[model samples]
Target: MYVSARERKLLERLLADDRDITVGELAEELNVSARTVHRDLQGLESVFRRYGLKLAKRAGVGIRLVGEEENKQALAAELFRLSHHEYTPEERQLMILIALLEANEPVKLVTLAHDLNVTVATVSLDLDKLEQTVEAYGLSLIRKRGYGVELAGSESAKRRLMSDLLFRHVDEHEFLALMKETIQKRADAPLDTVAEKLLGLVDRKKLAIIEQQIEQVKEKLPFTMADSSYIAFVVHLALAMERIKRGEAIHFDPRDLQALQATKEYEIAHELAESLEKVFDVDIPNEEVGYMTMHLMGAKWRNRQGTMMEEPSLTVGMKAQQLIRSVSDKLGVDLSTDRTLYEDLVVHLKPALYRLEHGMGVANPLLDQIKQDYAELFAIVADGARQLFGDIPIPDEEIGYLVLHFAAALMREKKGWRVLVICSSGLGTAKILAMRLKKEIPDIVSLEQASAFEWKGKDVSAYDLVISTVPLPEEYGPHIVVSPMLTEEEARKIREHLERKTSAAKRMEKEPTARRNKPIIDTMKAVRRISETIVHILDGFSLEVVKRRSVHEILTDACRRLERSGVIVDADVVVEELRRRESLGGLGVPGTTLALYHARSFAVLRPSLTMYRLDSPQTVAGMDGEPMEINTVVLLLGPADADEEVLSVLSHVSTLLVKDEQSAATLAYGGEDEVYSLISGHLEQFFDDYWISMKE
Candidate 1:
């Protein structure tokens, strides 16, 4: 099984925890089967054994590597070479400066230029390049006026950059030489003290073993400056470890670490140490702990040897608590809602935290389960953060986890509405109707299947809406309806009835107005004139016109004409919105009608008759199964604020067409006189008791 580079990198990340990882977990992370992971593990084991290491696995447990520290360091170096190519000298120099700037608080541009011996302009350009390069890795370059450039992103991204670029490439012999040089440069007492501290970390046997390995490797290959720098890092790591073991609180000069010219890894390690302390209440001296941890975890590959060791169960309850604390602090939320909630959250976070700590790859099952259980809580968190933070700019992973917590909270609080749908028969047509209704009307709380017989017994009135295959029982009250098919006519009628009922309720709440006679004739004349102007403009174009054009085609043609005439700015944008609306559902009102809305103050109603020759007869789905071949189009235009009035008129016109065949035929072939008469007749009856009587 020859693994690809991506697979190999994934395996390396999995092994970074330097502990046991299950085949199932690996398979889940890689989106593959357990058998495939097992095969990959077997191949890795063979490679390990060939390098004088063993791949050990326990049944019901997972796989891991075991070897001496020095050999592990060597293996880490080799693996680093294989996994990541070294940066060019210029890239390395820029990375070094970036690391320094990030590590220090408020590093000034002038100060950085002075340190790097480069022009300020060059520094600026480098910062710009760095900003662009870091984005893909989920990191950002933060430029604060007067504070200089700093790296901002996740702890994981910081660790990866440090480990891949700085620590892994250092040769053992050169690392030792660098350590000796550092000691020599320091005061004798301090140097001796640091050396002793480092020596104390290893016992006599281990010390001899490490020294011999370093000596042998040096003899085999001469040390380079890069190797020496790495040795200095190792010595610092060992010293830090000894101090940690002794429970000594030690702080070294930032300048000393800075002197090694390994600021990138040093700063990363320092940040990691600080995070560990803040999160876990466990402090390690310097960032050396992070560096040493990486080396130890990736050591087998460093030495080109294989050692099989039972994978350690690195799961730590403390670590989970630390993660929870860190996240809460970052979010500025009181996540500790009592001992039990805190404990449960930590338990939920255990697998992910452990994986993060050890560089092991672990799927976030607990987070997923929490999200599944508490969707509303997640929504609230997102909403709350968005309100407070303005954007709540978190990565998807954090969002996903936070959503889970939010949902759980909401479920506990019972904050949102609960809707139940009652529909006749758990069969095909009812299911389709229910689905369509749900999609069309998002305000409905829930949908459930209930037969007419079942509906009588259920609390039908409690539900938001109910659809039935047969007419509901009288006992079910006015809450029920029969609609086996979710046709456009049925949906529109239901929506319109709801709107009218809502309007009537609002009207009842308002105070009575002084009555006055509305000039119905004048308004009708204005509407007709505006309609005529629109028809004239549309007909003026030479583009091919269809008698019964679909709303989408009409809008597209209208937009093209608008752009050609320079009548609209960003016509393409409006066209896109029109197309999108059409995809949702056709925007056409039933009957031989076209409506145009304008935001300007003037109301333009003009009517003109023009014949559109259709290439082929187009069928429009209209009410009453009336297939309309509308050769004559009646275009209506008005101020955008009059949209409500326009909609009401269109609705009334549709009703008239459905009830009166004469009105439809009159408009289809009516000359100017006939068209005017048809519109006036309908408006008189509609306005008489409605608009005119309301004004009076």
Candidate 2:
């Protein structure tokens, strides 16, 4: 049975809340006026009656669903089953827009109305709403009494609109499943949802081929691409291929094309285009390659340490600094010294500005939730962006990404439990989830992020908890599914899950012999591994005065010291890697007179930490992308294939360096014994925690 989205919502609410709910409450919950609620409720009775239930309204008290529990459950089942295609007014309007955009010729309003299961008048009103939206993309909606309705615009604008719709409606998991053809369809499944219709814009067979081609060349790119970005790239190629086949051409400014050709992304794009020509047997244009290059540059996600500031643009860096200052002034927080925030903003805004100027847009599925969850922060960020980037018309999607960078910086913390955050985008939303968990819950020592595509075959046992934005298979173990924004209720659910795990662990402790499937030797080995790593680091740790005057010289001296101490097999190779890492970005910790030079290289034999005090201070770029004076150099190194425990311990030490002013002071000026004691104390506490986990 078919049901209006509103009626279905009202019915679901009534069914969920066994107690009577007033009309005012329902209206408020649904964000509608009481009159609208009454109108929606008018036909809900018939919908409920289909499953043998009744909607009873009292004279003065309120309204309630009166029926057998089984009947109510049956009605709920039906509602859930039909929810996919029961489009709301907004969804219906979106579908109509997609239909018009996808059409080659004018389509009859009756046909659209019939397809949407709405009246012709409703379709007309929807077109009215969509006119402004289309015009925003430099497109116009054409409607005539006899000629029917069609979208009139350049092929480029239409393609952009189509891409925007797909990104907004077809979620990441759904896009992957659709491309892989893994979306199982039931016999009664309806294939007319707004998302499904948007996906229809691309030919599935061609999409799969495009995906395969991208997979082959994706690793050749310099930086990692977020999963959502990967999906967008694939969709763009598929759409471009389809349009090229239809004899439509896309244009790129000749001057802009010249500038893009100098970029590495352009070269990669050109290579991919050549392969497409060979496979698809179509002539590809330089403009298409230029556009693809822009997509690659804009969608880049940094994968390695210190790479965020490579060949940084002075203009974008200053803009990032100014934006941070603006937000700091508005929020009354001193974020100007946050080096990580500054560098992240620089990296994000560099391409972000490009996308906006070129009329490229990305979809943020969590935009609404981000606005709802961080309303005040959103306004502040919006104000900051307006002041820093005047008249750029930055979309909320981009603003949402900015908010995540600031939010993660604000909520940054260090505690003692490991968590893995699996997300679809593996960029903005995932950062929000990780920071929110650290802020709301205690003892999350470290959090690792992976894309939904990367979750397969992961060592789940390494994490204290696995939380995913998308649902995982049952074989992956009990992971809590949550929204990217991580609503308060979802946070509460995660807290409960952790509490239950802790309780069970304690129970196991109480019964020593129960469930002894875990071998004693295995537990002892974990203990030994953690202990050995801690001891090795402490044994090699040293605080000495050095006469090196430059960053390169100081790093050389530090590497030689590590080499002599047998912590690294080769100092020269390690020095070169550290120097290369330094060139990418600043190693100096903000608000401290120390720089952390860290790397994971084959030259390092074990995890080690050492501090070198310079006789005279030297100027170097700070992590915040600003120059700062440093009198101390802190070196942290680990093997390329370090154990999880070893990595965690080294990460803990890194956090301790800038943990606070006192820790920084101690590290910079403290004597050798004092420094060793400080690090050992923290590591000892970490070991104690690790020991407990192993025992459990």
lDDT winner? 2
Candidate 1 lDDT over residue span 1-696, tens digit each: 344443554445553445566777777767779887777666676556555666667888776666654555565555543522233334334444444423635557787667555677877877776766567556787887777777776544553444333333332222333333432332223211112322323222222233333443332221111222233334434344344554544333466434322423334445445543443345665435444434333221111000000001111222223334444555566553322223333333432333344443212223453345445555555454444333224333444544443323222321111233443222223334544565455444434454332355665334434455444346666653434444444566556644554546434422221111124565566455434433343343232345556644665566555546554444556556444433322222244432121112122222112223344544543222334443433322222233433433433333333233465566555565565566656655554434332332
User: So what's the TM-score on candidate 2?
Assistant: 0.66
Error of model 2, residue 657, in angstroms = 22
Q: Number of clashing pairs, model 2?
A: 3
Q: Per-residue CA lDDT of candidate 2, range 376-437, in tens?
A: 99999988897778868898989998998998778765545668899887578788888789
Off by over 4 Å in 2: 9-32, 35-88, 113-122, 184-190, 300-309, 312-315, 487-489, 503-696
Q: Please list the residue runs of candidate 1 whose C-alpha ends up more than 4 Å from where it truly belongs after superposition.
A: 1-102, 132-138, 154-160, 167-173, 179-295, 301-696
lDDT of model 2 at residue 527? 77
Cα lDDT, all candidates: 0.41, 0.77
TM-score of each: 0.21, 0.66
lDDT of 1: 0.41
Q: How well does candidate 2 match the true structure, expressed as C-alpha RMSD?
A: 8.0
Model 2: per-residue Cα lDDT at residue 164 = 87
